[model samples]
Target: MEPINLDKIAFQITLHGGNSKDLAYDALKAAKEGDFDKAENLLEEADKEFNEGHKVHSKALRSDDKENRIVPTLLLLHAKDHLMAARSEITLIKELIELHKKID
Candidate 1:
């Protein structure tokens, strides 16, 4: 539970979460442009990034269990926030993509 290691994991979570969010937005943009194939590809990419972030978050949680206690930290919380926001955005973007396709 070195501080530096925790910081690294936190930063990784944030980075992957941001990447997922960005990919979802790109998917939405493609959908708006009526490029369904591209949109689907982008969405898949987003899913992959989200999974990566989730894995990091899971590892952090497991690490805490091994340490026998939870250490509350702002960076960890921020990373969790980013993960949540990315998940929400991806869900909404998926629904919007479906609606846009129907409209098209």
Candidate 2:
């Protein structure tokens, strides 16, 4: 595929990844405030955004032929970094939310 196309996908991944992370953080905030229902809803929204980002990343990876893989550019790497960090943040925040629920 063209580099411009790859850049577009990378930008999308980063955007969705950032959205996911923000939603996760919002969920944690809601949990801290004892609004468990809202927290759960936010968590679901975050998961959806995360999945969208992951799908774009997967599509970018799969777009390449077997003989020649997609070249990872700096923007792509940055996007991946955002995605992984968001994933980890959401996972940990889920645990933290559960703990908060138990405490409450």
Candidate 3:
């Protein structure tokens, strides 16, 4: 396999991550308001975006050694922030759905 350039991969990952975060936020909003189908669709879209970032991440992992890790970049920090938000949204949505189920 060809090695991924750290700089280029980081840019792509960051964009996808940011988009995924937005989708996740929307998903959670829809879920909270009992729009389960819309919420599910939004979550699926977010997962697709997350998977794109995961692709870049997997490439980085494939290309890097412990001693050769890429330097920290703002893009990476932004990506991490988005990833954190998305993960949080997924967890919160799951809980919200369960609570809704109980209420119904």
Candidate 4:
């Protein structure tokens, strides 16, 4: 297999992660406004973005496994941070949406 482009993978992860977070926040806003349909749609989009990021991350892991070593870098760290944050935000937002529904 061709050598993996770590930089590209990092950027892709960051991009998807950031998008997921943004969409999740937007979903929360929609829920707050009592637009549950829109909120659900936004959450779906967020899931898609999160999945894309995860796929890239998995590819990187596979590459590392094949090489039998891990390469740590600042960009990769930042990308991972974004992914984790997005995941957390998505979970929290889903719960908040449910709460909003109950309160509404």
Per-model TM against the reference: 0.92, 0.92, 0.70, 0.93
Error of 2 at 54 (Å): 0.5
lDDT tens per residue, model 2, 3-99: 4377898899999999999999999999999999999999999999999999998877777777667888999999999999999999999999999
Runs of candidate 1 exceeding 4 Å displacement: 1-4, 66-70
**Per-residue lDDT of 6-101 in model 4, one digit per residue for the tens?**
789899999999999999999999999999999999999999999999999997887786555668789999999999999999999999999999
Better by TM-score, candidate 2 or 1 = 2
Task: Assess candidate 4 and give its TM-score to the true structure.
Answer: 0.93
Worst 10 residues of 1 by lDDT: 63-72
With a 3 Å backbone cut-off (N, CA, C), the pairs that clash in candidate 3 are none
Question: Deviation in angstroms for 101 in model 3?
Answer: 4.5
Clashes (candidate 1): 0
Instruction: Give the clash count for model 2.
Output: 0
**Residue 22 lDDT, candidate 2, scale 0-100:** 99
Q: For each candidate, C-alpha RMSD in Å?
A: 1.9, 1.7, 3.0, 1.3
What does the lDDT come to for candidate 3? 0.74
Residue ranges of candidate 4 with Cα displaced over 4 Å: 66-70
lDDT for position 104 in model 1: 100
